[model samples]
Target chain A: MFEKLARMDRRIIYAVVFLSLSIPLIWPIGLGVTVGPETKELYNTVESLAPGSAVILSMDTSPGGYGELASGAAALLNHLSRQGIRVIGMGFFDTGPSLLETAFGGSDFKNKQYGTDYVNLGYLAGSETAIARMAKDIPGSFPRDYRGNLTPELPAMEGISSAQDVALVITISSGTPGVPEWIRQVGDPMGVPIATAIVAVNVPNMTPYMQSGQLSGMIPSMKGAAGYESLMGTSGLGIRGMDAQSISHLTILALVLLGNVVYLGTKSGASRGGGR
Target chain B: MRRELPVALAFAVGVLMIVSFFFTSEPLVEAAKTVQNWGVIIAAFALGLASVNLIQIHARRIIRGKGLDWLYSGALIFSMIGIALLGIVRGPTHRTYQFWFDALFVPGQATVYAMTGFFIASAAYRAFRVRNLDAAILLLSAAVLMLGNVPIGEKIWSQFPVIGDWLMNIPNLAGQRGMLIGAGIGGIASGLRVLLGIEKSYLGGSSS
Candidate 1:
């Protein structure tokens, strides 16, 4: 029995995980989610932004990260749109601008006027250096908006000459040229508050920044997205996906525990047989 | 002159950048900005170079007529050109371009990422065995963390979140900080080597 359990086919595990993740999506358990302090801080920071204040939304992730971060970005964008904050979108990664468009198009901001409530400055070529240049001169860094409009004349970009003018900077990041780059190049030097909606793998590394106050707030991952959705009184993908995440974690944990138990039992039995 | 000129340029630019950080003089700052701008231009060129290199390697594979390899190479080249042309001519915001990205590229990337969960589960089942005391502790901590991040964890035991947060805040933070500090020191050392022309690896040659 122990041998059979130990040698279970990997395909079975994959099927089990697929079912564990899928069933929850089809019929959610609707488990309660406790909002973490960091997520709350992020919510409060954006909430405190005065109406019409300009904020920099740097989409620094590719599609792989977008899968994990899209819900969080959507919830945050919804909150921002509701609060009447003007957003200036930009991307470090080449793929970021399109993802930003997709996120914005799906949000409550659909009715929001382009070039007035929000505008995409599109992708800049340089990574960290581009960020530094933008901090110094936003107009110089991006001469034209993603849609080919002159950035200097855009309504959303009015009076936003540099990073300092923005009320806050939020980086939805997956990798390098991301939160750390923003913090080093703009946030610290310009005295602007920085926040992030980062993928799950980055949560631990970024926690120290939150603790030290370099980051004003953070949405840790999809879980953070769900918490933000709950805060906003909306049911989005984040909330819908949490059931699967919960079940998947439990399944992995059970597999680990069962594997250990089998190993221990086999070892003990082998010892008794050797003694006989 | 090839090696000498490149080394001299790197040393001069590296020193100027470091000096500008400490001084507020306009000329030094301006020089630093110019160098940074040059860096950006070079990086852009490098990207073009990489694309050219990709095209060369794959085109060669097709020329060699290596069975399914040629097919894959053909597909890659076709996709690359198709996407680039679509973006350049019609713009990224065009309906057709957006549809390709949304329906095809995004799902392809998401599928690749989603597969990791299954792989991780399989790996955990096969590899997470208690062979020693340290292994037991590691397994226990992993279990705690896995459970704590999920809603079911708190449902099973409210303490899961509390313990998980404690583990992350205390031990995890300490370890991360140590790594950051160590990396910072190593970076400074590497920068110095490059600035002094002691590290010629960046110039496509060994230090020795």
Candidate 2:
């Protein structure tokens, strides 16, 4: 039985992972995540905004990571929308446009009218270069909307030229041409207050901007997303994923300890045997 | 000329973009906007072109029969051309195109996303071999996080939440912050090098 356990088929592992993930999702552990200082800072930055404050949201992740980030992004949008702030939603990547539509179009914020309450400038290409330009003259870079409507003609573009017109820029990015580019291009020079939410792998890259005050605040991956969601008094995918993430982290930690114990014990036994 | 001109052009564009970042003057900004708009159009075209390119390459490989599986290649090419023709010839609004996209594209992308399960499991298995003090800490932290995340563990043991929160907020944030600083510096340095023409990785392969 022990030998069989040692050489267990990968299907067993797959089943374990699937069951482990699905069970928590079905019956949430209701694990409370403490909203960290950074999350609070992010919340406050958006919260402090006066009504009619021009805000830009850059959704720069594909649909896959979108599922991971959807809750935080939706909650943030809801918070801003409640404030009656003017929103200009856009994406730096192609697939990002659809995800933003889903985030905003969801039940929580469905009544928000397109082009009046908010506008989607759609996916702009050329990666970081487009971001740099959009920071200056938005219409200059985005002459038209995704549907080919004249962008300058839209009410959302009223008095909005350059990053300065934006009171705050919240970019939820999964990777490159994201937070750092915003800091370098818009926040640093244009003085637009920048905030960002990014994947766990990217949190390290985003920290300096937050530290430097280039970014007003940040939501760091699913944990950060969960923390932000908790503060909003709404639990979503981010909060739910926490149990699975926590368990996975702990499982990895336990395996590491076991491996070390075996290694040390073997080493000691080998040393004593050599001495004999 | 073929390689060097494109590389040099990329270098020049990179500089212009960097300057456009700080300057924002009319000419610089206009040039930047023009370049960006052109890029958007080019990228849209590239997406379509890439699919066509993929079909051609696979079709050629199949014909040559040079260490390649012809039957599989044929199927792939047929799908590519099929989709392209459906969109271009029959129009994107046609039922055929919509059906192909919904049936093939949507599910394929979803399956790809779901495949991350295999990756995470492999990574976790490798990472969880506790060897020493740090390893023990990591192993323990991982277990706590997993238990806190999964329902059964929390159902059995209520204290999982507190420990999970601590693991994420303190150690996780610290590790993430360290990485962010390193990445920021790397990004800035890389962006500068590109602007200065010192890096030509974007110009494809070897600088020489």
Candidate 3:
């Protein structure tokens, strides 16, 4: 039994994980969710933004990272719309603008006027340097909006000369030229507040920034998305996806535990057949 | 002359950028801005250069490769050119361009990323053994974090979330902050090396 268990086919693991994920997704368990302090702070920060205030929403993620971050971005954008804060959207990643378009369409921004309440300033080519330039001169960085409209002509961009004109900067991020770039370029130097909707892998690395208050707040991974969703009194992908996320976590834990148990059993046996 | 000119240019540009960042001198700031704009234009050209490089490498594969290697390369070349043309003619915001992006590219990349979850699970199970005291601690911490981040963990034990937060905020932040500070200092040291022309690795050779 130990030998067979030790050499189990990898396909079994795949099948089990697929089922564990799919079942919860199909019929969500609706487990009770407790909002963390960081998530609540992000909610409160957005809530505190006054009407007509402009915020920079940079979609600095690729399609892969976008898949994970889209839920939180939608929820945050929805909240931003509700508070009547104008959003000036742009992307450091080339895929950012298209994802921004998707985000706006899926959120309440679609109901808001394009040039007034929100606008997509499209993508800039340079990575960190572009962000620095944008911080120094927002209009110069993007003269034309994603749809080819003049940026200065847009109502949402009025008086938005530099990063200082915006109330806050939020990045839905995955890779390089992301949160750290924003911090060095715009946040710390310009005294502009920065926040993020980041993937799970990066959450640990970003905690120090959060602790130092360099990041005003963050929506971390899908759980953070769910917390933000609950705070908003709305249901979307974040809330629904939590069930699958929880199950998958538990499944991985179980696999680790089971493997340890097998290891112990094999080690304790009378004579190991030349060991594992 | 070949190497000296490039190194001198690098030193001058580097010093100029550092000076402009710290001071409010108008001419220095303007020069830095122009240099940054040049960086942006170069980055845009780099994208085009990358596409050409991809085509060159894949075209070779299609010509000389056997079996399905050519097929895969052909598909890659086709998609790259097709998408570039579509975006060029109709703009990236056009529905047809977005359609191919959303229908094919997004899902393809997303699927590749999602598959890592399964791989991680299998790999962790096989490899995460308590071989020593450090390994035991690592495994224990991983277990705690995994359970704490999920709702089901709270259902099992209410204190799991609290412990998780404490673990992350205290130890994780402390370690992360140290690494960040160390990295920041290291970056400055390296920048100084390159600016002073003591590091000539960028010129494809060791420091002289």
Candidate 4:
């Protein structure tokens, strides 16, 4: 058994991981997650917002990271809509506006009025430069919404000319010109509270911002999405995927432990055999 | 003259942006806003230029290529041209344009990202061997983090979340803050260098 384990093929490991993730996803075990402080912080922030408050939802990720971020975006949107917040959506990434369209369709935002309750301001060209421009003059930066409607004409855009006019800025971000970009361009300079639904890889990078109060809140990756779902008392994709994520985590742990055991065993045996 | 012109422009623009940030002088602020707006338009043009560049390189590869390289290049060119034309004519919101984007691009990119999990699992099995004290510490931390991140960890012990919180909030926060501060200073230094014309690489040449 030890010998077979020692020479295990990479394919077997892959197959095991695939099954571990898939089986749990197909039939969930309900190993739900705890709502972390960051997720709660976001919830509290949104909860405190007055109705008719304007908030910018910037989609700063492509489809590659969107799969991971979509659940969190939906959860955040759910709260935003319930709070009657006026959502002014845009994307720094070209894919952002398109994805925002899809996210809105899938979310409760669909039930709300388009121009007044929410509007997609579409994709901007100049990454961080675009963000900086938008900070000073939102209507000037966008000019036209994603659907080719005049942004200034939209009821949601009324009285919200710049970042300072908004209550909060939430970026569903995955890469560069994301959280850090928002922090520098809008958050710090204008003093608007910034929040994010970010990718897992970026969660570690964002901790300091959360601690320093530079970022008011964050929904971190899938786990954060799951936590947000739990807090909302609705089981969405985030909650649905948590079982799979948990099982996968355990599966990787097992692999790592087995790996170390194999190493120790092999090393001891080889040393006894005169460094064979 | 070309080199001198771009360098001078960079310096002026950089100085203008910095000035707009610190001072609220109306003329300077308005000028900076105009420059930023122009930066956006230029960026849109850059995207178009990038597409043309992609086509030129791939078209060359398709002609003077070897083995399966020509096939790959041809496919890339075909996809790029087909999608670009379709998007141009029907608009990106058109059903057919969206169909291709949704059916092909999104899933293809998502699959590529998802496959990393399998590779990571396999790598962990073969490469996560404990060799020394440092290795053991790393392994321990990795285990704690993995367990703490999920529900089962709490099921095993409630303190898992608390410890994980401590790990992230204290040590992780400290490291991230240090890096952010250092990077911020480094970025300002580089920005100053460009503004002072001490860095001319932006003009497609070696820094001075």
> Which candidate achieves the best lDDT against the true structure?
3
Off by over 4 Å in 2: A244-276, B1-25, B31-49, B61-111, B132-208
Poorly placed runs, candidate 4 (over 4 Å)? A1-3, B1-4
**Model 4, range B1-208, lDDT digits (tens) per residue?**
8777887899888888988998988898789999999999999999999999999998898899888899999999999899889877887777888778778888899899999999999888889888888988888888888788888888888887788888888888898889999999999999988888888887775666
- DockQ numbers for every candidate? 0.73, 0.30, 0.80, 0.77
Fnat values, one per model, are 0.66, 0.29, 0.71, 0.74
lDDT (Cα, tens digit) per residue for candidate 3, span B1-208: 9987998999999999899888978899789889899989999999989989999999999999889999999999998988989999999889999888888888888999999999999998788899899999998888888889989999999888888998999999899999999999999999999988889988885778
Q: Which ranges in model 3 have alpha carbons more than 4 Å from their true place?
A: A270-276
Error of 2 at A37 (Å): 1.9
Backbone clash count, each prediction separately: 0, 32, 0, 0
Q: Write the per-residue lDDT of candidate 2 for residues A1-276, one digit (tens) a residue.
A: 323433446566567666666776778766567565778999999889998878999998876666567777877887888888888889987666656666776625578767777887887776776786577678877788754678899887789887898899999888777887887778877788988887766665565466667778888777777887788778777788887765555444444444445455666777888999
If you assessed candidate 3 against the hidden native complex, which CAPRI class would it receive? high
Question: Which pairs of residues clash in candidate 4, taking residues 3 or more apart in a chain or in different chains?
Answer: none
* RMSD in angstroms between candidate 4 and the native structure over all alpha carbons: 1.6
Which number leads on TM-score?
3
Model 3, residue pairs in steric clash: none
Docking class of 4: medium
